[model samples]
Target: MNKVFLLSLYEEAVRVSKPKHCLPQYFNAFSKNDRVCVLGVGKAAADMAVEAHNYFGSNAYGLVVTRYGYENTESTGNIEVRLAAHPVPDENSVTGANALLAAASSVEPSESVIFLISGGGSSLACAPPSTVSLEQKLSLHKFLLRSGASIEEMNTVRKHVSVIKGGRLAAASKGQNTSLVISDVVGDDPAFIASGLTVQDTTTPQDAIAILDKYGFDNASPLRGYLANAPLLPKVKGDYKLVANAQSAIDAAVEMAKASGFSTRVISYTEKGEAQEVAKRHAQIALECKQQGKPILLFSGGELTVTLGDSKGEGGPNQEYLLALTKYLDGEPGICALAADTDGVDGSKDVAGGFIDESTLRNAKRKKIDVNAMLAEHNSFGFFESLESHIKVGPTRTNVNDFRVIYVS
Candidate 1:
């Protein structure tokens, strides 16, 4: 398939997984008269709340926290919409967290508390404990992001430090609580998605400390002490359901490819590890497909990490994944690939991700962009920008982790 068709398939994967399309099925299960205190958290939170409002009418009214620029004010009926810092928490994140807690706690026993949780909710729904200040939490967030911690490990620390996470939000409410989640984690475990705001948290503070120690984070004594003394979440009752995830998006993309007459195979759904390492492994798979001399589409989905350390580069994990793939392939013919965060933002950049084919590096060299230097600095965005190879889709208002496609023809 050509680049246009391949990119369209990726877009289809995202659109099919959007909150506006998938949430209504779950919303219809709840009673129409149920007073819903909706706590929408993630990039898709506001859009999810709007779907709930459309179904429940005036019964749905609560706080929603999405990434900046994603809060849809026009269609957000009854529900209160707010913006907060993502990938890192800010003062406004604390404010939004408090509002979500107050809204949940103030509900009557007969009311139904619904949490629309997704990826990025861990930072968006921030409510640090009294012992940990907002500034301290911010510092810790930055440290963990740079520490190369997995989503599970980062959330292990997040749940202990935050009051709203680790099922504490559900404990505060004496109503029927249900969490409709869009899973971005590898296993699609509800607990890791947004740190399990409404689900039961089995991990203790010691678990959080263990994760911190494993990473050798600097000056974590104060944070460790806080976790050591932190109170456990009160036993709470709630229901958690996975409405969308990486596997679902990958399946959609695979189906699209098959319909277009390409021999498609789902390589994996829960792939993980460092971005560059994963890219090298995937490039090997593509090489195998090319050697077989048949048109084939390889599909995979998972979130990959980029350890920034001190490297100040303007790119996300998906960009790094593709750039590294190009280096490994070395302009191998008949191989084309695309990698992107289904949420429409990769790492800290607005671009969804980058695209690469056999000529990607050659095109970059013509522009005098040194791919090696850019890769060394983790500056994949700069490299792709020079070649106009980055995919820009804005916010699709849904996140199901990273979507990747490799075509060998």
Candidate 2:
């Protein structure tokens, strides 16, 4: 029953953020007669495009670029869907970026251009400047992922290196532009979501350079030289709306928990930091709730980072968080937890996340699993898989970052 309740809360969070549920209401602002050209990019791009196509019918036509394997099968007659690599951009990412730029540039002044932007757009539609080779950009991305940098810091560097991000797409358009964003970053800032494809950028190239320097990135790269003389980003005129965000998902989960008669506390809607460290903090909170001697639910949202260093982890942040959490929990009775990405993919793995309970440590002991060694190697996926505790829900079609729930009684 605990497992069922926890999974339901996650489902509720994902459901509310999906484009079909949250996007159509925003479309009422545009007239049916208006000429619509939609450009969608990110994990949720295809679904957002399909929603626009449904609303505008014959009038809406454009392109969508999404992470590979995230395409929606829903009929979008005039809208083209292109798949690209994510986390690290590839050749397909360049192709998608160019296509999106061309489509944005071709929009007539009389037309209404709508950008459906979400998480993963930074890599799914990468278009670096000529001075930075694709190989260099890829290396930078790989380093940042393991550098323990915050999403804001990583995207700060990305905005400076890319030609299509940092409001360049909106700058290319001749039409009145509007951005409907599903924010995966904390604070729901449109400027950082998908690296702000349709919104004007306030961060400078120096800001990117500073972030790279703070992360101990190689100083001799040619990209640093390009950043030294990078052109100022153009100011774009556009309407930006955050249709869904981590807060939205958290709110939904709160309602569900309340309905289930659990005393609920929302620790935060904007969580960050290293996965294991964050887990240690949350474990202390769980213990406090356990002492209260009443049924309670603790919730949090926001993306967490994992600094891989020398160890090649087989797990993403969510799984790693759970593994570390189980250790701190120490098989405490009447406590269980779940941590998952709302977008369905956690880290680079196909698994959503993991589930843990009071029996988890005992189960591992019975199986003779070396929990400490697995955690040290960043192999939380293997740890959970050995116990059959990992959750797998492929491509929820929306991303509002990570969703976590802890239940104590």
Ten residues in sequence with the least summed lDDT for candidate 2: 288-297
lDDT (Cα, tens digit) per residue for candidate 1, span 239-337: 878999988888888887778788998888988899999999999988987887867888889889988878989798999999999899999988899
Q: Considering every candidate listed, which one attains the maximal TM-score?
A: 2
Q: Could you estimate the TM-score for every candidate?
A: 0.97, 0.98
Off by over 4 Å in 1: none
**Total backbone collisions, model 1:** 0
Which residue pairs clash within candidate 1?
A: none
Q: What is the lDDT of every predicted structure here?
A: 0.87, 0.91
As a TM-score, model 1 comes out at 0.97
**Distance from true position, residue 298, model 2, in Å?**
0.5
lDDT (Cα, tens digit) per residue for candidate 2, span 1-409: 4888899999999999999999999999999777799998999999998899889987899999998889987977688999999889999999999999999999999899999999999999999898788999999999998898988998888988999989999999999999999999998878889998889889999999999898899889988899999987889998988899999888998998888776899999999999899999999999987786767888999889888888987889999999999999999998999999998988878999999999999999999987899889999989998999988999888999999999987
What are the runs in model 2 whose C-alpha is more than 4 Å off?
Answer: none
